[model samples]
Target: QVTLLQTVVGAHDLFDVTVQLQPGGGIFQTFVRGSGDDFSVVVPDVTRVNKYGRSADCTSNNEIRPLCYCKSNLMPTSSPSSASKSTK
Candidate 1:
């Protein structure tokens, strides 16, 4: 199971976010709602890239799930010699 860092939300428990992929590839903007135990929005799961983002506004009923943005690895740089320390 995933372990949360344990945080408290204000009376309105939701936050908006805008994530940019490595090398400024693309931006992922969304407002995840709820504690992530059980929350969802309209999405197609039969295929890949199956996830939805926030609704038109905060008052909308269709709220996406809450998730903590993180980084597990580094993206490649334009430099051919750009290298990272081995994780092994």
Candidate 2:
């Protein structure tokens, strides 16, 4: 199963987020920088790594590159007073 690992308020309206897939799963290191509704996602491997987003790899007889990234739309949601978000 995939789980959210960390969330830290950063400077310049940026937030650091980390997600880990359990039991030998892919680890996603993502960054979200924004406030309120709209946010930007920063996936460093978005270019090189194929996660079925931005770039993709489908299995076939001619070419077979397994998907190495996990897709789970998880975000932090709670009062700032509590540590609802888990951290690494």
Candidate 3:
């Protein structure tokens, strides 16, 4: 969960965000600046991002689920060759 601290009007919309981490009960605050579809972290630089992988089968309330990728998601849902042999 995050709370909006302040918003500044300029060329781009600048705002302060305070992130309240669940489970561990920690706090992370940062400045996010962007306009329209573009946005980025401006200070502290503590955020970690996962760039590659498949979608994770995580619960809706999991905070980091959006950034997670599970190896199980890479596995095929079913094998066509195996299914054919079994049917025969």
* Number of clashing pairs per prediction, in order: 0, 0, 0
The TM-score of predicted model 1 comes to 0.26
Residue-level error in angstroms, candidate 2, position 26: 1.9
Among all windows of 10 consecutive residues in model 1, the one with the lowest summed lDDT is: 41-50
TM-score, every prediction? 0.26, 0.35, 0.41
What is the alpha-carbon lDDT for the whole of candidate 2?
A: 0.44
Candidate with the greatest lDDT versus the true structure: 3
Write model 3 residue lDDT over 1-88, tens digit each, in one string.
Answer: 7744577656347877766554333455678888789988877454423222235454454566544556566556778989899999
Compare candidates 2 and 3 on TM-score and give the better one: 3
Instruction: Give the poorly placed runs of model 1, Cα more than 4 Å off.
Output: 1-11, 36-88
lDDT of 2 by residue, 7-47 (tens): 56446666555555442244455667677898887554422
Cα deviation of 81, candidate 3, in Å = 54
The digit string of per-residue lDDT tens for model 1 on 20-74 reads 4432233454444556586432232211122333312233343332221223224
Q: Which ten residues in a row have the lowest lDDT in candidate 3?
A: 47-56
Q: For candidate 3, what is the lDDT?
A: 0.59
The C-alpha lDDT values of all candidates are 0.34, 0.44, 0.59
